[model samples]
Target chain A: MANLSALMLARDLKLLLEERSKAVAYTSSQTHSSLAKGLGILGFHPSQIRKVTCDDSMRIGTALLRSAIEQDKALGKTPFLIVGKAGTTNTSTVDLFIELAAIAREQNLWLHADGAYGASALLCQSRRAILCGIELCDCLSWDAHKWLFQTYGCGMVLVRHRQFLTESFGTTAEYTQDAAETGESLPNFWSYGPELTRPARAMKLWFSFQLLGLNTIDIAINRGFELAETAQSSLEGLKDWEILSPAQMGIILFPFHPHVPAANLDEVNMRISQSAIENNLAATLTTRVRGVLVLRIYSIHPNLSDDEMLAIINGLDQLAHLYLSRASKDDII
Target chain B: MANLSALMLARDLKLLLEERSKAVAYTSSQTHSSLAKGLGILGFHPSQIRKVTCDDSMRIGTALLRSAIEQDKALGKTPFLIVGKAGTTNTSTVDLFIELAAIAREQNLWLHADGAYGASALLCQSRRAILCGIELCDCLSWDAHKWLFQTYGCGMVLVRHRQFLTESFGTTAEYTQDAAETGESLPNFWSYGPELTRPARAMKLWFSFQLLGLNTIDIAINRGFELAETAQSSLEGLKDWEILSPAQMGIILFPFHPHVPAANLDEVNMRISQSAIENNLAATLTTRVRGVLVLRIYSIHPNLSDDEMLAIINGLDQLAHLYLSRASKDDII
Candidate 1:
């Protein structure tokens, strides 16, 4: 559904520009590939997609974006859509939405926030501030299946103006004409997205919200943030462990390196991840941070206790030690 | 899933044309709007989409398609993809796939069969012939949810070459490196479509097939065809009723006209549809045949008894009589 949202916004933006051949879209290189996939689906060529470099926190660089925008304009290219990553997939890093929104306003570009995994954070008072200026976005895509703990098929797209969606996808056939004009009392959802025969995606979100109030959902999200902090503090205490990205919004990116050099650091971290999977220890995976491979954890489960966090650390430490010991033993042989 | 399949194919075809600015796609005007929607999502302009006129049977006219292709080429547009409707939404009209395949082959264009509703008929030996030359198509999109008695979220896409899907959507991020190279033994589905985190849509189909067996599923589909035949025969016998399109592949289109002029026929059909919804009756719908309004019944449910089909006819006939009487009474007053 997040993809649907991006595609919808991109299509409207293109239509709004009247199919400018040189029209381009902008997003952080670290933002989820779904946005790029959606843009590609919406007929934007790979060359037309400008992936602006991100900062150390994996946030889009405002200066770099402005420079790229200016460069594109000088080259007779139209930059119309700018995406802000509210919560990146790699480390749950929230981009500087306020800064991005300001740039978008200055350039008259459509601002979209890909809050697929992080928009639920808005329900939590402590974490909501991370997504400052989110409301200023022209559109936002969020997934209830991700952080809200609902099953799949519950992603949502929010357009500042609802009519934009209807205008984008409101074409109806003879069979669908009645439903389309059923008035505001009956919303023909097919007019809002691509799929015509869609499953009731809103029901799951509605049921969850009804059964567990917003307060309860917020508490669950807050627990994830607490657990990430714990994981970060625990990693810092380890002698061989180095924090690549501090835990924020329920994710941490760290690498384990003892005597391993920078060249072999990626190899060791990869081996540890493989060992974790091989031993069925945990779901710890590896991602690159600033071109360096590192272990990444998504501490999003509300029920994950401190004991589980400790166990995860212990498991990683033991695996790393085993991998190093094995390497040393191979060398001796 | 059907949308993803079409978009993937459309994107690859455009890329194959080396991002030709004048690339165009062809489909019957009677084809599902999803095809056009997918093409639009893939960046094709409304002008690039050539909606070829359909024949009386509502199938795509091949002569018109060939002429359109020539016209587009003459206009410096490269026609890349041509979509054939296996079972159109309105009349269950199966396009002349054999003729379409010949045209696609002669022109070297990618042929995609939008069989979302009718492809399941392939499981029944007696009904498979309706989709003759289906094997010649480059790609096909089918929905298991529609006729296979599976729940929603069960749509399948078949490509002539396995590598095409991977070639279209096989990019990997650092975080996805481990899963991307899981070897030939394990298929990474994310590399085959736009979605990364998709629900296990195949499980429902798998369980249905395992529990009910292919033979039973085939029988269910055949039952729908039988009921459609029964509906066609029944509708033909009714006085003042005209059969717009004969029952084929579990769909029948007809209109009841009792002293009603051609001008208000559309209104009458629409009113019947609205009344069906308001009265909480069967899910009856209306469609257009050669710009004429008609009521369409999809006899897709396997357990739709002969009695039920008769009851639907009776209800529609009674409603038509009531509408005509009310009109005459208003004229007299």
Candidate 2:
């Protein structure tokens, strides 16, 4: 929802200044799919979104993004926005934000960061450097529910300049004039977002922060990094397991590719994931990286101990061997 | 939020079938401002919405709406939707939904009913007739928080055909495939609305219904009507008061216009409303009816006794007399 609000502001600003109805937005192919869905909601055609290819590390290819913008301009399409990822959902890869900011500045594009899960790393002193250039974004969407330990429905969108938000979402009606700001105080908060009668979503976050001071909260965030690192180190010790993406932002991806036919890797890994859940072990899931399916582990729970992480990884290795043997038996039959 | 979702579905359906990029929608001028705001967020220009004027009783002007649709059609614009009000916010007037449905049928436009407050009337067997033809709406947005006594953020949008909603909001991503349904039962709910990671909003409503049961809920809804009626009758017995709108759907509009100068009516009434708040009498507010500012009362509390309603009205009368006499004394000074 924060991404939606940022795109709304970007759309309104582009229309106001450029007056071009056929505006295009650029984002890395590894970025969350919500960006395209939001742009679709904002009435942009599917073709209006340019999913620029990412490099081998799943970081956005800055050169490709520049070329895409140039190509759009040549095609008479107005390139208005570049959505950078602080931490992408699939691989937890942080985009090259410094380069992205540079391109946005050169192309005169609105820079929005989808920092839903990754922005929470800003709480940790050591991990904060990974999101260094995020401050250069014109807008950033952070979900407190993801890494801040809040429940669902508590996400926030922030803009560099408050005027753009009001310009994009300001509302007036005959029935609500009494509640309008009197100019001596803060503006009516309704102008900041789409909702009019919104719940006090910030209250929960305030309570959490007050109860857990910055020091404890920072430690909890760093624990997420520690958990992911533990999973990566444990998986590196297991034979026939290849790390597809290293642990980053509490997420790691790998596939158990035994010395079997390469074509059977995806199915064998998928069964291992299913076996983990069936045996009541870990709730591991799979996601595509580059084009191959790999098991993805989200180890953000602060309560997950290092021993538990090691057991889950070893259990997955056992499941992979069992599944491979079963496949070989079926071939013999 | 419900209205926004309805408008999104309508926009997508229009784009899919008519393929008219330049589409217009019609709504009564008395409709909630959220309609225009939602349309704006959907990338519709302000001029694309035709706010057809309302009649003296505050119902939609059906003839004017038909003429407006005709004019837009004549200008090569596609008339894609008609938004009717089940209960308008200002005067609590319900629009002519049957006529609107007919016009929508003839014009091949989608009919959406904004029933944020009034749709709850459907629960009362006696009051349900007032919302006749609401069932004919292709889409209806009902807020349980408003009239159903749930807390805020509990609004539901209903569509006659569910496929339209899925087609409008369906999503596919590599990361969420495991959670996708196998088509053996209900579809993944994420496809039905804008939210992906939503709170269980329906749980509260279900608990309310389970504890209170339907009979108690019907009486509570009926009590809202009784409170409004009591306010209206109490105001009628007093002198120098005019009813701009009768009690309907738990709302009444009136102004304490003493034999003072007509030019001072708005100011005097506004002051009377302010004095009500200052004296801790009531929380009466002001709204415009036919360009005249009048005190508006929303008496939806089921616990408000008839005597309390009468006392509140009498207090407003006393405040009005006090303010008017003070104004006369100031003139003498």
Model 2: how far residue A161 lies from native, Å: 1.3
Q: Show the lowest summed lDDT stretch of 10 residues, model 1 chain B.
A: B11-20
How does the DockQ of candidate 2 come out? 0.66
Give the poorly placed runs of model 1, Cα more than 4 Å off. Answer: A14-19, B1-4, B14-19, B271-281, B330-333
lDDT of 2 by residue, B1-333 (tens): 899899999898866532435689999889887898888887788888888998877788999999999998898888999999999999888998999999999998999999999999999988999999998999999999999998888989999887887887888889997897678386777788887788888899999999999999999999999899999998889999998899998999998878877888888988888889989999899888778999999988999999999999999988888877888998921
**Per-residue lDDT of A107-169 in model 2, one digit per residue for the tens?**
889999999999999999989999989999999999999999999999899898888988888
Clash pairs for candidate 2: none
Candidate 1, what DockQ? 0.55
Error of 2 at B120 (Å): 0.7
True contacts kept of each: 0.45, 0.65
Q: List the residue pairs that clash in candidate 1.
A: A41-B41
- Model 1, TM vs. native: 0.95
What TM-score do all the candidates reach, one by one?
0.95, 0.97
